[model samples]
Every structure is written in C-alpha cells, then in structure tokens.
Target: MAKRRKKRKFILRRVIVVACLLVVGFFFAIKVLDLFGEGNSKSEESVKEESVTKEGFIEKIAPYAQELGQAYGVKPSIILSQAILESDFGQSKLAKKYKNLFGVKAYGNAPKVSLDTKEFVDEKWITIKGEFRVYATWNESMDDHTKLFVEGVDWNPELYKEVFTSKDYKEAAKAVQDAGYATDPDYAEKLIHVIEQYHLDKYDS
Candidate 1:
C-alpha cells in the first residue's frame, strides 16, 4: 500500500508538470499569434492610408512640375516635393483658398490673403497671420513658383542660385533649404522624404 501511494503521488506530480507545460506552450503560441496579427494589421492600415492620400496630390501637379522644371532648369521632383510639403498635398487652406502651392508670400500689398501660418522662430513654432499670394489657377501658382526660383525672392538673385544650378534632385533640395525656402530646419529632409515616398524622382527625368 505504501509503494502504491508513493507511485500515485509521483504520477500525479508528473501529470501536473505536463499540464503546466501544456498551458505555457498554449499561452506562448497565443501571444505570438497576437503579435503577428497586430503587426500585420498596422502594416495594412499604413498601406491603406498611403494609397488614399497618394492618389490625389502629385498626379494633379506633375504636368506643371515637368514643364516648369524644364523651363527653369530645375528638377521636377524637387518642385513637386516643395508643393506637396508646403500645400499639404494641395489640400491646405492656403492651397485651397488661394491656389498657392508653394506658400509664396505676397508683398507690396499684392493680391493676397492673410492666413494664419506657423513659422519656426527662436527654436519654436510661432503663429502669425502671413500674407500669401493668391493665384487665378494652379498652373499660375506653378508658374509663379518657377519664377521664384529663376527670378529669386525679393528680387535678389542670390537666393536659390545653387538650386537653379544643381544637377541632382538631392542637391536641389539642399540648395532650397540653404536659400531659406522654409523656416523648418528639417525642410530638406522632409522634401527628400516626400520625393522618395512618392517616387517623385521619376519626374526628375
């Protein structure tokens, strides 16, 4: 009877150990599946968002970008990227209300609208009502953008001179930042990201 009792206890312990192992394995498998499922879900969400947003913006501007790029001897990709960034895929209030794709501000009381714009100043973003140029059409906006690079800002030819001469899209991006195209320190990086993400470089050709 003692031997039998001891054998029963041993078997019970073995069964308990096996049950715990099975439980652990089951939970681990569940956790792994959860992780993979979440990852895939997030990836699918990102792809969906990209597809929706990419369809409307550049497609409308590429013809103008290509033509102006050729006329001004600049990379079409850079021009398109600038428009995409400044205009928020041509959906920003400034772009919508004024058809301003490049965020070119108006001076000397030109036809313009005072829009609430954020500018990076003193290492922080400050809100200011800036005067932005209004365009009759998007093509006019693109034309004015090209003229800005060719004719320069404030009638000063020094600005964007390197950009006008750059042979590569990347170089033109750097030159744009160097010429103070935007107050954001990461302006070039953002442009490059837009350029690469949308394959805007194809227009550069």
Candidate 2:
C-alpha cells in the first residue's frame, strides 16, 4: 500500500510540472506577440513621420516655385518636380551645402563645386566628375533654374522655349527631355510620375 501511495505522488508531481511548463510557455508566446505588435506600430509611425517630412519640404518650396512660374511662364509642377528629383527632397549634400537644386553646371568665373555624377552615355551609364553651380540660397538656385528656361543656354538661345510655352506639364517635361536638360533617358517619365504622384499639377492652377 505504501508503494502504491508513493507511485501516486510521483504521477501527481509529474502532472503539476507539466501544467507549470504549459503555463510558462503560454505566457512566453503572449510576450513575443506583444513585442511584435509594438515593433509594427513603431515601424508604421516612422513611415508616417517620413511622409510628413517630405510633404513639409514640398510645401516650403511651393511658394517660390509658383511665383517663379507666374513670372517666367514655366510650369510650377516642372520646377518643383525637378527640385525634388535633383536634390532628393533637399537632402542631398550638394543641395544642402551649395544650394544647387537643379544640378546646374557652373560656367566661366561662376562659383562651383566638382562632384561625382553619373551620366547616361552611349546607351550605358557612366560615372563622371563634373562641376556644379553654387548658390547663396535655395531661392537663388530656383531663380537660376527659371532663368535656364527663360533665357536658355549660350549655344541655343531657344533651347528651352518649348518648355516654357508648353500647354501642360506633360508637354513641358517632354520639352525638357528633348532639350537635353538631363542625360537620363527616362527624365521626362520620371518628372511626369513625380508630378502625378504628388499632385504637383494643382499648383499650376
């Protein structure tokens, strides 16, 4: 009888240990799930913050772009889109330090900085060192960008005339591409995509 009692106690201890282990495992799973939920929430919040910052940058430049557009007959959407693309939303080292938003090259005695740039050449992309213009402020950079469309370049006095006289943003983007404003083959497409994605055409009104 005593042996049977001891056997019963041993089985009971085993049952209790198993129950405790199950409880601990259940709690651990819940803790892991909570941590994952928190991580997702934080990630979503970070995306939201990044979006807000981008929108803020756009708003900051909109006024100047619009004013320039009105004065020069250039599309505000084109100006804003180029700025966003060239400067990477005003975060590029060139834009931040030198204030050259359009990647405008320096000529003659103008202040400039030499930077590594990529150009599409002979159906392939290649890295090249080029000199870019330096500006005192973003406004100056924007003004010069407007002037490029208004006054054109030294080689072709009417190079960018179509860009300013375009009836819509799409035409202007195509004009810019045709005028060889950028070496990228998809330059016009990129401008159109950005203008549509951000609703930049609203500024043209």
Candidate 3:
C-alpha cells in the first residue's frame, strides 16, 4: 500500500512539472508571434511610404538639370550627376535636413545654419559658423543650385566666360572642374558617372 502511495505522489509531481512547462512555452510562443506581426506591419508601412513619394522626388528635381545646362553651359548630365553624387540622389542626411543640393557654403550675407560636423576646406577641417542656403522645398534647392553656377562668386567668371562661350554643357562641366570649383579629387569622374548612370544628358538637348 505504501509503495502505491509513493507512486501516486511521483505521478502528481510529474503532472505539475509538465503543466508549468506548457504555460511558459505558451507565453513565449505568443510573444514571438507578436514580434513577427509587428515586424511585418512596420515593413508594409515602409514599403507603402516609399512607393508613394519616391517617384515624385525624382520628378521634382528633373527640371533642374536642364536649367543648369542652359544657365551654366554645363551639361544637364553633369549637373544632374553631380547633384546625385553630392546629395545621394536627394536622400542624404544633409540634403534632407538643409535642402542644400549643391553642398554649397554661404559666403557673404547668407543666413547661417548650425552643422553637427565641420566641413573640410583648405586641406583642413574647420569648425565655424557657416552659411548654407535653406529652401522651402527640394525644387527650390535644385533651382538655387543652378543659379549658383550662373551667378555665384564661387566660380571664376573669366573661365566661365571663355569655356562656356560655345554654351555646351559637356565643355563647361569639364572647365568648371578644371578651374577648381571643388577640391574633390574625383569630382569630375563622379559627375560623369552620375550622368551616364541616369542618362541625364537627355535633359540638355
């Protein structure tokens, strides 16, 4: 009789252990399912957002290439390419935040904007209160970028006058790079890459 009693107690303990394990496993399974559901929902929302606005951003900036080609005698291809490289096709943190498509720094009475990091210049990085052109929209940023080449002090007037006399975008882009408008070693190459990749030259002619 005592042996039978002992056996019954052992069975009860095993049953209790199994019940506890099942409860823990059910909670874990629910938590995992919730995590997966949340992940899928967030991914779907991201895809929807991207689909809605990606093309619009591309369209809005497209006109600037032609304008730059006409005004600066720089190939629309080069202008478009350079903008893409500098701003990562308008997806860069700086471009998104400041609307500075050309990565231009304000020289004179322009309004100043604070930057989290210093910009490289004269072979050194310096921290200073710098001015950047702020715009109401991406289109405004692209418009200003074109105007800068046409009317800004950054480019040498004499070089532009001589090189762009033909009003050819290709020649003008090369001249601007040769004249040291930017210190980047691969600036010209990058512009060419962008132009070829996107066939941006179509906008010029």
- List the candidate numbers ranked by TM-score, top first: 2, 1, 3
Q: Which stretches of candidate 1 lie over 4 Å from their true place?
A: 1-50
Model 1, 1-205: lDDT tens digits are: 9999999999999999999999999999999999999999999999998777766678877988898877778789998998889988888988888899899999886799988999999999999999999998889998888888888866687797898788788888999998988899999999999999889999877
Cα RMSD to the true fold for all candidates? 5.9, 1.8, 4.5
Steric clash pairs (candidate 2): none
After aligning candidate 3 to the native by TM-score, how far in Å is the CA of 3 from where it should be? 3.3
Task: Report the lDDT of model 2 for residue 101.
Answer: 91
Question: Best-fitting candidate, measured by lDDT?
Answer: 2
List the candidates ranked by lDDT, beginning with the highest: 2, 1, 3
Stretches > 4 Å off in candidate 2:
none
Shift in Å, residue 201, candidate 3:
4.3
Model 1 has an lDDT value of 0.88
Per-residue lDDT of model 3, residues 32-140, tens digit only: 9999999999999999987556445556677766765676665566566666777776787668887877766665676546555455578776665645666667667
TM-score of each: 0.74, 0.91, 0.64
Worst 10 residues of 3 by lDDT: 154-163
| Better candidate by TM-score, 1 or 3 | 1
- Expressed as tens digits, the lDDT of each residue in 65-93 for candidate 2 is 99998888888999999999999999998
